[model samples]
Target: MATKNVVVDLTKREKLDGTNFDMWHRKIQYLLNEQEVLETLTIVMMRPENGNTAQHRYDLETYESWVKKDHCARFTMLSSMHNDLIGEFENYPNAQEMWNQLKISYGGTSATILRALTLKFEKYVMDSKHSMAEHLRTMSTLIRDLKAASNNLSNEQ
Candidate 1:
């Protein structure tokens, strides 16, 4: 019989902080996928109880161990944020709910945010007085924001 135990190292990373939700989401997502626990975020393993069979005991032990490891990873990443941000997610029992809650609170509906970003980009104009670098920077930033908002435009645009 093999025991499933994970020794997790909670490394602090600013990229996981809520200040930049787009980047933070991507970074944490990549981490979870790489760790092979992305599915655990959405699919919670059931704790088999009331059945003393060997398979039931095995299932319970494995499920609990996996949940703990998954939770540890999620919490460590979230710990990078300020305490106030932490408060918003404390009620979630698993990483998937926490991620979804954060997304809704910070990102809003994709259509709504995209409309705003598109309008902002449309209104942006580079002044002749500004340096070429400054002009490019302004345009590039708006473009990046629009992309993050899930607005895809053809290269011609």
Candidate 2:
């Protein structure tokens, strides 16, 4: 039997370690090295807006070249999803404008995604009524697990 698939929307603000956190932001940053990944991400995310085949090909070529030349050292492959989706096109001086325009061209798909996440978080905050001890406990457990995994990996090596 095929396993059931569960989609998790993790952009909602969640409490952890006694603090409210943007789970999506943390996940994105954890997957990417800020400096090295930004350049490639800028180009990729902006290409759809420009819709120039030549420009798209050029950005891809440049991205390949930079990777080959190790100009992307701070970046890791773990960030590929975001890199492929939107980060790569963010380098242009007017990339924000490009994205905003793309957002319109795409029938507000991006805006819808943002709105969904925002609504989920807002509802969660309201439902929780600001109690966060359970969230803190959950975070502590996650941290402990991560530390244990790291230690195990080091020992294995």
Clashing pairs in 1: none
Worst 10 residues of 2 by lDDT: 1-10
**Deviation of model 2 at 14, angstroms:** 12
TM-score list, all predictions: 0.59, 0.23
Q: Alpha carbon lDDT of residue 129, candidate 2?
A: 48
**lDDT tens digits, residues 1-157, model 2?**
1111110222222212111123333443443333334444344332234445997778877656655423332222212223244444344244234334433433222444444433433343322643488766654544443333232223322
Pick the TM-score winner: 1
Candidate 1's residue-wise lDDT over 1-157, tens digit each? 0111111322333433333567566656666666667776667666677787998888988988888867765665566565677776777877777777788776643565667667777887889899999999878866776676667777767
Q: C-alpha displacement of 37 in model 2, angstroms?
A: 5.3
Model 2 regions more than 4 Å off: 1-38, 41-65, 69-111, 125-157
Off by over 4 Å in 1: 1-19, 109-143, 150-157
Write down the TM-score for model 2.
0.23
